[model samples]
Target: MSRSRGSFGQIIFADQSRIYNTSTIVGRIRVCGDHFTKNCYTKTILGIKKRKGGNVSSSFVRSTTKSGRRKGIRSSHADAAPCGQDAPEKDVGCKSRIVETSMPYADHDYSQRPPSLEEQLQEAQKTIACQEELLKLRKNRFFLERFQCDDRLIMFYTGFKDYITLMAVFMALQPTAESMLGWGQSLADQHIIRKGFEEQSPPLIDQFFLFLCHLRQGFLVQDLATRFNVSQATVSRICITWTNFLYCMLGSILVWPSREKVNELLPLSFKNTFPRTRVILDCTELHVKRATSKVLNSETYPYYKGTITFKSLVGISPYGELTFVSDLYMGSISDKEITQTSGILSLLEEGDEVMADKDFFIGDLLSPINVRLVTPAFSKSNRKLTPEEKLQTQEIARLRIHVERAIRRIKEYHIFDRTLPMTTLGSINQVWTVCALLTTFQGPLF
Candidate 1:
């Protein structure tokens, strides 16, 4: 029993420690964050009293030694708890806490404990072991390094094209596996790319496979990085490099045919209905990330997309074969300017009719070349079109669906489905070129 100097008397706690000074005691009640457990408490827990009519019937006391370190506790209180904190239960203790901040790298807990020398050594050894395993996997072999347990792996990553088609593309790009064994010999002999000082990187087949995997599924760069056990930057570099490589190698596969060739391969549907039509052409836009530079924003902004974009003129043959794909132009350019500069008009033969949407007002542009521009009828003086003009527009619309389908096929390659990144905008034209050409692999557009 203890007494104070004034009218207050001390209630002696037999086993529990009482608050030494009432006014001096820090009165802080905490609600435990752990809903899964009742035994969570603040780091510093002060003893509290449970009273009925000013007499203490029971006391919730947390004790510590002279060292001032709290011990394990297992008790629950009926008294009110502070915001976001709960008193530990009578059956559960600090030892039963779901999140023990005492440990290093606790999950969902920001608490961190500095590593000891032994832990640091173990981590270094683990890193070294991983590096050694990676080196073993990435050794100079081909065809079965990164993936490729079977053909299913190929289709899952590189689209639904057959293995033969995939192998053809791979071989065309690789040309000689011998070059893959060395450096740039495959592309160097072909002069597609010059040789450079080789860096220790993944094999050619693996790189090609990686590129295909990215294109086929449009996986995020970070995901590819983790899959390949490399950094996102490395995955990005591989994507850009292989994008250039595949586009350069495979682009010629979908070449614009001679007039005779185009005529010979024309599907009867086009030959009978739209005989004079050589190519259906239109301008398409791909939304890209907004640039920080005002000039860049203005240059890339297209009113159609209501955002920054890259505009390309797509020309498809009568049977849906891509006749030509132009380089990406700034969205700011007029359709007439793009048509004149895209080298598309040059591909046109004299007397060839260019079937297009009404927006492609290039009849005067085509007139000097002896080429014709055919589009739906336009109203004059605010009057409706004649019946003949309406029938003509229906015919053109029915035939023009093929070009739209061709564009849809290109856009199906998910990379172009979303807002493109500005960082890789330099290589985006190549990516676009590749996607456009890949439609050929889908076979005759009919």
Candidate 2:
């Protein structure tokens, strides 16, 4: 037996002893196994039959079957054999061999066709909608309800004593806020500017909460927007609207105590040392961002603070209520000038005494209004103060410290701790005034 490759690339085993000598041209032979046929021979092409007048190529091989007859190899049909009953079957002495090969896309083949662009887009839209719903579910929807039970959180976030007081103030302001045409809206237009997007604006109470958060927390507009789930523009509008609204609403209330009211609330310490004191005045400076213009820079630069600042005079009743907050002036302005221009003198009457720090040289200004100035005595000509003057200075110092405490309360808002941006210049005065007034709600300073 010998093994060789046939022209069709199939392995062929032939018995050399059965070879027959014949003048015949044999072409490639293909053998397939078949069990149903007796002869087991299907269509066959014996290459080319040799004839007397026909030419046979020498490259062709000659072979014969066991009967010593020529056998053809090439078939006229070039198509592959089908695997069913209709295909011609051939029988050989061997069983059929099963060949296994790896398929490249076998595991990756999909049962259905890939989705089209429209289908994918629709799926993405559905996912986004679901995500939005989940976000809304996770976030607390009501600002007031969320903090109503937590007074510390209310204080931390809005500087209110508790939810009750917060709501009380809101209730007082709500009527005017609801009745107004809108934020800075004209009476003729009759259009009210809503706090947020029309479809998703927070309730009026929540809008008030948002504004309080902005003021007390000193949160940026973007931060308030994110916390409230509104646009930055909406937060800005809310802040401006509420600032003006509060400036008008709260400012309408008279904070300056009258002479009898001051005497009624005056503390014993003031009564013993300075029995006639009406109010204690002090000058405080707030840091402000540098301005673009040279004139602004020069005018706002406070020599004491070494930075651009806004100067305001804060006056408290002897008992520590912040009775007066002067409009912000340039840092470069003198305390005497601020006192002269702050209009506090007009509010004072004869026999009313004003107590202040030694830096205030406004005794001349007060004298014209017939208001007495009580301040710590300064040594003159390097002379030591007398024992009585020393006791008087100590008493004045002890009594004047309350005004500093009042200023500290105002500064506790934290918004004034940092240098204010120039953009807030428009409403910063109102902000300062509102903060000063809100401290009255913190209970008595004494």
Candidate 3:
């Protein structure tokens, strides 16, 4: 009888040319020749057998009849398979080889190390030491450049530091004397002045030193000319050039501190003694030598000093800073007239107080601005003060002493303590302004 194979078991099919491919079937059955059966019950080719007591059944053959045909069948089976051939190969022995290669070997070593904190500190210290050494070298160079010996050595020794200190004190103090000498010397060397017989003039540094001594120590123009072996006209011209230069340049640097700043520096003692006091005001006489013209001399002549003089109003703060210095007024002018003419009276405001001597006569000028004037009590018709008036006068005097102290401090500068030479009035005033500015640099007196 003919047999049919089920699709659930292995089945082999061949084309007409005798090429065969194997496939598994899920339904239906087929038989190839008389020896093979494909059915669900078959486990292997050998498991197929003839059924007992039945018509002869197909026997499954385990081996191919030809070896080359078996090889071809195996090749066909591999080609037809749906899976298993593409699976990745396993590396069972690779892990240990990888670990061995990754580890560092004892034959190799690294010697690099980070710097320590001590090394870093030493480097920083060396840098700072170099900077300090450089600064010292620069200072030594500057000292050597300016140091010189001359006839003015004694004067220079006494005033050098003071002069330098004063120059350093105010940004407004011009180096005019130094600059003019430099310019004059250059001009002399270049023969630029008057186009005349060129014998190089004396060094300007020497002349500047002499000029400084004259200004600070009041050396006579004739004396300086003789000392420098120059004409008086040349000396006078040098003085004028330096003085004018200083006056213009230094004037801009002498800025007054703000009233608020002054108020902040006021001492508690001053505040308690004179409440709401704005400034301590006083007028001082600066004597001048006699002039050649009588009319000119009379105009400058001050009856009180019996010599030609000028009047200036000096105002000091509680901290002893020179707050204000009025422009020069003729000595013939009364203190009241000077105060009015100088525009100082215009600064008073309501609720402010100005302490002054009886010479100020500022009551009328200050009253309109609501400022109270403090002065010694005076009786009518030049009469002596009563007991109450005397007590008031004493109280005023006690409060007024602070301004006197401020003035005394200013006069301590020898330039102002002595009678200023008429030839050096412009220079002396400049010196005074600079000295006053220098006082502020010494820290607040209050």
**RMSD after CA superposition, every candidate:** 24.0, 17.9, 27.2
Task: Report the C-alpha lDDT of model 3 over 1-446, residue by residue, as the tens digit.
Answer: 11122233434533322322333222233333222233323344678543332222223223455654543121122223222223335211211110111233454345657669999999999999999999877555312124443324433422444444433533343344344443245655644555432233334445445555555556677877776667777776666655555556645664455567757877776666566777778987777777778886887787877888877787876566667777676678887887788776666556877889987787888887888887887778878888987877887787677677766655554556566557765555665554444344444445
Screening candidate 2 with a backbone cut-off below 3 angstroms (N, C-alpha, C), the clashing residue pairs are 28-73, 34-90, 45-72, 46-72
lDDT score, candidate 3, position 250: 48
Q: lDDT tens digits, residues 1-446, model 2? A: 22234332543433322221122222333233211233323343766422332333332345679998888443211132222335335222222233322334555446678899999999999999999997777557547677789999998878888999988998998888877544545776554544334547577899888887777878888888888888887787778888888888898999888889988877788777788898889999999989899999999998878999999999988887888999999999999999889998888989989888888898889887788999888898999999999999999888888889998988888778778999889999999988888888887677
Clashes of each: 10, 4, 13
Compose the digit string of candidate 1's lDDT tens values, residues 28-146. 32222221222222233355522222222122457677898886332343232321234334322222112211234435544667789999999999999999998886653333443
Q: Of the candidates shown, which would achieve the greatest lDDT relative to the real structure?
A: 2
Question: Which scores better on TM-score, 2 or 3?
Answer: 2
lDDT score, candidate 2, position 251: 89
Candidates' lDDT values, in order? 0.67, 0.75, 0.57
TM-scores for every predicted model: 0.60, 0.67, 0.52
Cα distance off (Å), candidate 2, residue 23: 93
Alpha-carbon shift of residue 401 in model 3 (angstroms)? 3.3
Off by over 4 Å in 2: 1-142, 184-196
